[model samples]
Target chain A: MKELSLNILDIAMNSVGAGAKNIAIALDEDDDSLRIVIEDDGCGMTKEQVEKLSDPFYTTRTTRKVGLGVPLFKLAAEQTGGSLDIRSVPVSESEKEHGTKVTAVFNKKHIDHTPLGDLVSTMVTLIQGNPDIDFLFLHTVNGKSVRLSTAEMRKELGDVPLSNGEVLNWIKEYLTEQYKEIERL
Target chain B: MKDKVALREEGSAATRIVVGMATCGIAAGARPVLNTFVEEVSKAGLLDKVMVTQTGCIGICQYEPVVEVYTPSGKVTYVKVTPEKAKRIVEEHIKGGKVITEYTIGNK
Candidate 1:
């Protein structure tokens, strides 16, 4: 993907496909690196699935012969002398607390690293596509942070759906303003 | 939440354009297709007149970069949409209010 945000969006879709009701995306940027952690309370993979996740040829999609999201992300991280980590515990009726976690660390000043694209749009798309899910996004750039929680938004919204255009506009403006603030700092 | 009520009061616009941007769509180049729609719609000053949003997984990955248009008339789905096609969609279907049948899902 040309943008890191695209990669995030792609990976996040996997969580949705796994039936995650709650997804958390955290981006932390320090002097040396930009780290992303995306965790989901979704049906997770087995040990074998987790092990083969990075292989381009391995995918659960029957329509296509290959899945490049993970492998491409792995390459993006590794090219910058960074790393990608994936952990999952398969879900079972007996155990409800099973899900998947993915973390990618990228060198801050790496020349090859793509800029994180419109993340607010990414978040909004996720919410709009899966309105019932709870999305919590935390972005900390040099310790200046902006946190957004849809669960809290829902509490405030009462019976109003998140799909409302007005609410979507507000969310966009709020995130854009926060992003500008971080850029200024 | 009150804001949502306010939006509902605003009611549905006469037309809405939805772009599929799921992983399948994006991998097939829906990002540019979406960007084109947003840009064209805004440039045409139809931001308030029309609603442009995104969706996930139309369940037809092979036919992606799919875009769907919803008007009072009905719904039309376009497949394998590129930026150029998106421009035409805004100009012909959206502006002219004529469904582009040749590019529609039913045609394929």
Candidate 2:
């Protein structure tokens, strides 16, 4: 993934493929930590399924699914001296509303680099296009928050798909600008 | 300081092509597209005119192979791109300044 956001998108896509209707992402950046949480209401996995998810060869899907997304996320977290936690519930119990939550916490001081810009852009792209799905994103820097609602971008773009060239370019520029602002620090 | 500032300015002025070359993209045949762009730019001796870069994922896995071109003035994204289409992009868009509407995300 170009950034964490891309990784998030990949995982979120898996959730959707698993029949999720809602996905929530929250990012918190502070002097000491950088935290990311992605939650989805989809068909949750069984204990056996969750246990094998980290294996590169395990995938329940039919499409060339050599499951690497979760492993990669775990590696990314570990690289930053961070941790990853994942939990899932089956759809049968929740009536197709399976919930999965993944949290990663990084040591900001140790991991001096993270692709926050790409993360935000990816989130924006996925959230804007999937109107049937709702995504809530909250970004915090030292306790100050900057929020982006996919609902807001959808209204602003007026029927344009988030994947459209114009909208993608706009998101890219927006992300680039946000990174520039962060670089000043 | 002088050299750094000049380099930064030059970097921003160059045309860039970012190919989505991750697994999803590669499975959809982005490698050949990237190779073709590299070859065409080199053969045309327009190395300075364009720079080819690879990116992980564009988030639209369904679109599989994606290519984005960022000129000095505008950015264009082409989705579900193939090698033949990549050649057309190099010949038409990169060299001739015309967008291939059929392959562009805009057409979709």
How accurate locally, in lDDT, is each candidate?
0.81, 0.67
Give TM-score values for chain A, per-prediction.
Answer: 0.93, 0.76
Worst 10 residues of 1 chain B by lDDT: B3-12
- Per-residue alpha-carbon lDDT of candidate 1 for residues B1-108, written as tens digits (9 for 90 to 100): 474254332235678888887667877878767767766786786756787777777689899999999998889999999999999999999999988888998899
Regions more than 4 Å wrong, model 2:
A60-66, A111-117, A127-132, A153-185, B1-108
TM-scores, in order shown? 0.79, 0.58
- Model 2, chain B only, scores a TM-score of 0.84
Interface RMSD values, listed in order for every candidate: 4.4, 12.9
- C-alpha RMSD in Å of predicted model 1 compared with the true structure: 4.3
The DockQ scores of all candidates, in the order shown, are 0.29, 0.05
RMSD of each: 4.3, 12.1
* Model 2 lDDT tens row, A89-134: 8876677557888888877667444564446545544543354576
Tens-digit lDDT track of model 1 for A17-73: 788999999999988899999999988878777788888876555523226778888
Residue pairs clashing, model 2: A5-A119, A44-A89
